[model samples]
Target: MAKTTTASKEGMAIRTKREIIKLLKQEGALDALQLAKLLGLTGMAVRQHLYNLQEERLVAFEEEARPMGRPAKMWRLTPEANRLFPDGHADLLVSMIESMREAFEEEGLEKMLEIRNRKQIIQYLSKAPSDLPLKEQLEALAHARTAEGYMAEVIDNVDGSYSFVEKHCPICEAAKVCSGLCSKELEMIQQVLGEDVDVERKSHMLTNSNRCVYSIKPKGSAVL
Candidate 1:
């Protein structure tokens, strides 16, 4: 039937976009020509898919300067694209947290959260620049978080502060079961960024927002 054919075509489009996302995630970036070659499709076909992905804000492109000739266009997955991938074992994690809460009580949950926060801070600090300015350090933190599938970015505020925005939360499923997970994450960021900077959760996805935003400014400084 006509309806069945339309559904089939939509399914194919979904599968093709999945393939494109997989390629981009694995290879980091690729041009339309390279993607077409990988997909065994024409460059124009690949570009059409890329256009749709871009419109959805799932993919982004950049220009790479070549040694000779003009800059080549390269496509890659945006942080929002991370939502398409399977999470870092969300089901298993949520179950474990629930069990901990039921068996060991609230104090035990707090201890577990603290331990997890320490580990995350150590991991992020290992890659984040220690000698950079607060803003630069925040940028590095965003990069580290994005690499871990958080889909984070840094925005400069007009009031001489910066906003750290995470468009996607890979562990949202886990955080929903254990509220401590979210609070500890904010604590971890504060610890990693140092005492000189104050980090405030301006917006939270758990509280009905589409994304999480952290307002960062120097200690004892008012928003200008």
Candidate 2:
């Protein structure tokens, strides 16, 4: 068996830190004890990583009030931590969009986006199951987005609807340069999800939020 060297141990620590960040990103907030449980590590080990992340300004914590002795510390990712995820050649995409606009004007640029939107709709439709339950269909949609570096997931809402959330937008910069890209995403999602359901944009990433959320449900009925 290969002996673990100092460098290898250090590498494991680094990987643990990243895993902590991913968990926080997906689950929103968690206490050190909770993180330790989920990661199969001791609380002390988790807290050490959390403190390092805090010092790096990649993570922060707020105290949650408890009825018992002491309040619990709930850790969450800081906005700066968003850099760790992929942005899908954001700078290059943004430059290409600007070049297209300058060469062809707004109308031509919109036309190009429309073509891209049509392709995107077809791609999503090809993967998302039309015959499954609305929630399961949304799960498939989320899986497709995740494969495209969107870090997407579906959540069950209390009001009988599903929330499809994209934690990271790989084309965020490009989307900002061309608002139609953002609208097209919504339009494509609506079309791909089928006419039997309604998809509503709830939160937007460009509006100071780090995530985009959409409320989806069957038309004139609950999802489940």
Q: Which lDDT values do the candidates have, in the order given?
A: 0.86, 0.89
- Measured with C-alpha atoms, the lDDT of residue 202 in candidate 2 is 91
In candidate 2, how many clashes are counted? 0
Per-residue lDDT of model 1, residues 1-224, tens digit only: 99999999999989998899878765567999999999999999889999999999999899999899999889987767756765768889999988998999989999988888888888988878556888888889999988887778898988989999986677888988888889988998999988888889998978855578999989987777
Off by over 4 Å in 2: 1-5, 69-71, 222-224
Candidate with top lDDT is 2
- Model 2, span 49-119: residue lDDT tens: 99999999999998999999799999998878877888898889999999999999999999998999899
Count of residue pairs whose backbone atoms collide, per candidate: 0, 0
